[model samples]
Target: MKLELLITRDAWQTQVAVLEDGLLVEFQQEPRHLDGLVGNLYLGRVSRVLPGMESAFVDVGLDRDGFLYEGDMGPLPDLADADGIEGKFRNPSIRDLKEGSGILVQVTKEPMGAKGARLSTQISLPGSYVIYLPFMEHVGVSRKISGGERARLKEIVRRLKARVSGGFIIRTAAEGVAEEDLALEMQGLLDQWALIRLRGQRAEPPAVLHQEADLVARLIREVLLRADGEVLTDDAEAAEQARDLLSSMGHPREKVHLWPGKPGSLFEHFRIQEEIDKALRARVWLRSGGCIVIQSTEALVAIDVNSGRFTGKRSLEETAFAINMEAVDEIVRQIRLRGLGGILVIDFIDMTKKAHREALFARLREALERDRAKSRILNISEFGLVEMTRKRSRRNLERVMTGVCPCCEGRGRLPAPWRTAQMIAETLSGRHAPKKAVVTASQEVVRFIEENRDRYAFPSGISFEAAETPRLSHFTIRPAS
Candidate 1:
């Protein structure tokens, strides 16, 4: 499969599109004003420690305090280990932290809605080939790399572990990487961590010690390097940066291609914007005429599949199976493209046969294997429902691209004209009703009242006036001059 990375950067924002086999599968955009906070390291001051909740709030110099849970405090030294008899490690309790105490923490999840940033004391610095765990003792390899390659990478890390002070998780990209390259990257991460620690020691509490790389550099390191893809960008500065990064990483600088098209045209030429618009909508139509409707709430995301128009030339069971199999592919694609996370419940078409249900579940799990986000999917139930949870570090695409409807206040529904009329009638019938009242409302509401004058007992002293208002459900009533 061929992979391509297209980047568009302007003064407003930077958009990155990852295409697999010339089809968009993942999209990300970072606005200039709103820099992402995840992966940042900070020397935070403990503002409050709630022993009852086993958590603490840390002031990280952000708009909101970062949350620190007990589990994220890493393996604390066990009291029983005072004698150094190889005692087991224990998780630190929230009571161990005092108010106004300073701690070094890293942001694991960005702030979403009312929640502050999720933080952890276990800091892990990621590189192109490995993730350096400065405090962890475990040296692991990516589960994707197996057989001799996995063993080889593990052995390489173990051999070099004696020289370094931290653990390493060899990434899939390190499967065929040489020992020298791994050693170099490992040392670089160690040096980086050393500097972060040094800076944290000297900095005051609630100070930022390290900030994560910008979106373009992050995607290049995390995505482009793993896929060995060509990077296309219209911005000369970004193109030059990509070339320099690739060259430093021992890759060909030519992989960073400077597109001749005008700024923002690269996405249009590849029809990426069309895909993005489709992702924003609730319903996504499959090639087979089947569709999936995705709805997100505060708690979880719900996906429902419907076999719209395609009536397969087979038995009912076969038809259901065909549509469901196709739905699985699109569902996985949508999940990645939209950057959906948190709990997801999928309501597939009910399949009676156990064999068919198992096959569908297996296909879905396989398709989601390519997703970078870590997810756990359960087996499909008898009612053809699948429940899964994906790790979320940042806001999803819809939340990033759209805002709550001001008129509906995110309810996705508006007050009916009849409802508005009823409110108007109630106001007019009050004992203190104005002797001469001028009511202003939306055109729809005003037309409803004018057309249905007999339905409502509006006082003769009251008159209705139409005004174009952005808030459809809003209206005003004032004493007429």
Candidate 2:
């Protein structure tokens, strides 16, 4: 499958879209001024220790203090158990960390909403072929690497583990790499970590020791290279940076393209805006006339699938299965496109046949494997609810693009203005009827009351006047002689 990465840089933010066969699959928006915080190393000061929560608030120079959980405070040793499986050592408690103490930490997750970034004392630096864990001493390999290949990579790391102060985790990209190349890669990572530590020692508390790579470089190193795709950017400066990064990494620089400024946006030119619009909506329709509704809560994301307009030629079970099969592809795509993470609960249409249910479950599992984010899917339950989770480090697209609705307080609904006006009229019609009643409401509500003024027949001396107000739901009454 042909893949391409398109980047558009504006004054405010840099937007990235990944396309497979001309279809937009993944999208990211990062502001120019405020990039992501993940992977950044900071010299933080413990601001507060919460033994009750087993966490601490750390000042990392951000507006809000970062959160440091006791579990992430240190690199607990890993030892092999009798069963030959690695077991974690005891973790340090939050009480061990005192307020005002200096701590070296790395941001594992970005600040979301009211919460600050999640910090970890066990700092790790990731490279193209390996991740250098400064506090870890165990050689590890990617779980994706299996069989004889995994054994070979592990042995290589095992031989080199004692050479450095920390251990190395062989990444999936290191497969089949020459020993000399692996050695050089590990050395480079160690050198970077050394530099970070050197800088951190001299820096004051709440200072940044290391900043993660920019969007273009990170995309090239983490995504584009793995996907083997061409990178296209409208910003010449960004394109040049990508070229430099790719060339330094021993990858072909020609794959990076600098698109000349066009009359319209690159997103519009590629028709990616349409797909993005669809992603913002709660409902996603499949070509087979099935629909998926996605709703996100603070705790989890809920998705419901329905057979909207699809009626099949076979049995009802077969029709539901077919629609569900189509929904699987879209559901996974939507999850990636929308950047939805955390716990996910999918309500698939109930299927009576056991075989059909199992088939749908298998299909969803296969589709999710293509997702880059780590995810776990649970077996469908009796209620047809499929529970799953996707690892998240940054805010999702909806949170970034939208805010709470002021009118409905984000409930997505509003009380009918007509009904509200009718209630006011009824309340004043009884013994509390005044000589004059002035109803102040939104423009729509004022018009509703004026058009239906006859419905609220004022008593003989009573006068009614409709006044428009900016507040959508505000209403007022007064007595006039």
Candidate 3:
């Protein structure tokens, strides 16, 4: 499969599209002014420690305080009890800290909605080939790198651990990397961590110690460096910067290409904008005439699969299985494209055959394996529902591209015309009914009242007036002259 990265940079923001086999699989956008906060390190002062919640709020110099849970405070030191037994370990608690105490924390998740940024004391510095864990002591390799290569990388990292101060996680890009290269990157990260600590010690509380790299550099390190791909960008300056970054990372700079296409036409040229528009919609139609309706609520996302127009020339069980199997691919694709996270409930058409259900579950698991975000999929329940969860670090595409609908107040529906008519009738039939009253409402509501005139015993002096309004439920009954 051919993999490519399409980067479009403008004054407002930068957009990146990842295509596999000429199809868009993932998309990301980063604003020029407000880069993401994830991976940033700050020296924060604890402002509030809530022992009841087992969490604390640290003043990180942001609009809102960063939230730190006890579990994310890193590995606890083994404290001995009165018996002084060596094997016993004490769990860390939030009560150990007091207000106004200083803590060096890293942002693990960005501030979402009304919530503050999620912070962790266990910091990990990501490099091109390896991630340096300053607090962790274990050496591990990427699960994607398997067989003999995994053993080789593990052996290399274990040997390098003797020289480095902290643990190391071998990235997938380091699968075939030489031991010397890994050692070089590991040293670089260790030096970086040292600088962060020195800065935190010298700086005042609530000060920023380190900021993550820009979007381009992060993309190269995390995405392009891991795969064999051509990086095409419309911005000449960005292209040069990408080449320089790749060269600094010990990779060939030739992979970065300058696209001579029209300015602001890169995404349009690749039809990525169309794909993005489609992803924002609730209903997605599959090639086999099956469709999936995705609705995101405050608590979880619900996806319903329907056999729209495709009627299989097979048994009932076969048709249900076919639609579900096809829906799995689209569901996974949409999930990644939209960057959906948190709890997700998938409702698939029911199939009676146990074998078919098992096969469907297997296919879904296989498809989700390609997703970069960490996800957990539960076995399909007897009601043919699949419950899953995906890690969400940043805002999804829909939230970024669109705002809540003001007309419906984000409910996506309006009051029915008949319902509005009932409200108008109730006002007109009040005990202090006006001798002369005018009912003003949207054209639909007015028409409903006029058509169902016999249904309501409104005051004889009342008159109906249709007016243009944004909401059908908006109506007013005022005394007329």
Scored by TM-score, the top model is 1
Better of 1 and 2 by lDDT: 1
Clashes of each: 0, 0, 0
Off by over 4 Å in 3: 75-91, 431-433
How high is the lDDT of residue 158 in model 3?
Answer: 93
Q: Write the per-residue lDDT of candidate 3 for residues 1-481, one digit (tens) a residue.
A: 5878888999999888998778888888899897779999988899999998999999999999999999888743222222221223334578877799777788988887789999987778999999998766789888889999999989988988875556889888887888888888888887887777667657788899899998888877777777888899999888998999888777898998888878998889899999999999999999999899999999999999999998999787898899999999889989999989999999999999999999999999999877778999999999999999999887788988898777798899898999988887777777886879888899988888888889888778889899987777998778898
Give a tens-digit lDDT track for model 2, residues 281-328. Answer: 999999988899999987899999999998888888888888888899
TM-score for each predicted model, relative to the true structure: 0.94, 0.90, 0.92
**Root mean square deviation (Cα) for candidate 2:** 4.8
Q: Global lDDT of each model? A: 0.87, 0.81, 0.86
Candidate 3, lDDT over the whole model: 0.86
Q: Local error of candidate 2 at 355, Å?
A: 2.3
Q: Model 1 shows how many backbone clashes?
A: 0
Query: Deviation in angstroms for 466 in model 2?
Result: 5.7
TM-score quality measure for candidate 1: 0.94
